[model samples]
Target: MASIQLQGKIFIIGEIEAMTGLHIGGSAGELDIGGVDKPVIRNPLTREPYIPGSSLRGKMRSLLDRHLNKPLRRDRPQVRVHECNRLADYKECSVCQVFGIAPSRNMEDTMPTRLIVRDALLTAETRERFNEIDTDMLYTEVKTEVVIDRITSAATPRQNERVPAEATFGPLEMVHSLYTLDTGSEGSVDSEIALFDTVLMGMELIEDDYLGGSGSRGSGKIAFRKLKVIFKSRKHYENPQSVPIATLAEGDGVSALRKADYQSQISAAMQA
Candidate 1:
């Protein structure tokens, strides 16, 4: 196995706007505020609702896991999702490469997890607005969802707290790194560009798919808006003289980004 080489880091900056309500479950017993059964996770200090990085990353990985339809491993029964345990499988699996997997006995089989998702918090403007306005809770709202009990077949009322629709969580940043790994090369595709595209695909999938809990019954519809991608080469960090490269389309939103085919632009920029 060849030693891994640092290629660069890509930053995906954007705003996650809730097209519909979003409910990422929080600790129920933590607080008895509002009497709502389900509450969205919040910052312990501020008590203002925010999206967890785990929830955001997990949802994207899960969507890709299903989209790729990779065969789930039998050995690790505890891990419910499909994981590429071997060197050969890890090289072939995009979900494992991008989202990553736990290292096995063969150290070369796995590399560092390329993606890092930051906890999304409400934008300054939005937070200000929320602070001023009257809400069921601080910066969040309580919604009642009536569900049916399977055995009893009775309508059960559930009060779920949510970040209301049209609310924006901004300065959303996702960092994806580019590393030349020695898992053994399979193709000529640039590692940086491929992983970048995989991350974009995850974001796209998440846009179509609901996030958080109660997605099927309507809760977590979200949109990535004002998206931009920036690249910082290995030299940029070591040397102050190096300038970060900005690779972005003409317009805002994910649709525009897809239309621009960011992979091609990023590839070009990386080489230049």
Candidate 2:
């Protein structure tokens, strides 16, 4: 920690807009007749549905792990994830470098986690719009789905509470910190692009894939919009400021990121 230098931070700012009904289930109380079978998670204070940072990050991590085809730990059946606990494996693995491994191993031997995803709350304007419309819940809607029994041809119906389509969550912010090891070797998504690309790839994967639960059933399809990337260095922190580097529109994220070597650009900016 003493020898390594933190060059700067790259902030990825954007909005997560639901293209279809989104459902991330909350607590299930005692089964009550006429109550929602599955309810979207909500902020206890506001009673408004929100996208938790953990959910977003976990989905991204899982998607990225799949993208890289990283190996799962068969040794621990309980914890099924790509862990970079080994010092040798960690040095070459950017997936775990960006999304941190569990601290089951020695902290001193491993690199610091690079990414941080903040909670994305329902936008105020979207909330206002939903208030005017006649949603079933405070800021959500309940849709009843029926399941059919092929054998008997009997139907069972259940209600699912979800954030209605066209709802927007923002201002979603993801921070990617830059740390240089005392030794020259560092894990990279590519030699030129480095760790920044992995974050962009995760975002793209989520957009093409889905955010929350029940993706195949068309519950959580989302798009990233109004993206802005900013750079802040140690000196910038001392001055309490950041520099805006780029702003992107919907469907222009990962491709735009891959077009340039953002790692080199940001590192140069950090040093400057």
Q: Which structure among the candidates has the greatest TM-score?
A: 1
Worst 10 residues of 1 by lDDT: 182-191
Q: Candidate 1 local accuracy as lDDT? A: 0.79
Over 4 Å off in model 2, which ranges? 30-34, 74-79, 183-193, 240-253
Instruction: List model 2 lDDT by residue over 109-197, tens digit each.
Output: 56678899999999998999998998888778888888999999899998898899999999998998877656334342224237777
lDDT of 2 at 258: 53
Candidate 1, superposed: residue stretches over 4 Å from native: 73-79, 104-107, 148-154, 182-189, 261-264
Top candidate by lDDT: 1
Give the per-residue lDDT digits (tens) of candidate 1, residues 1-272.
45676667888888999989889899998866687898888889988778888899998888888898878655565766777767888878888888887665454737688899999988887888877889888888888878888999998888989888888987899998888765324242365566677777888899899999888878899999888777776656766365557665534666666666655665565555
Error of 2 at 246 (Å): 8.4
Local error of candidate 1 at residue 119 (angstroms): 0.7
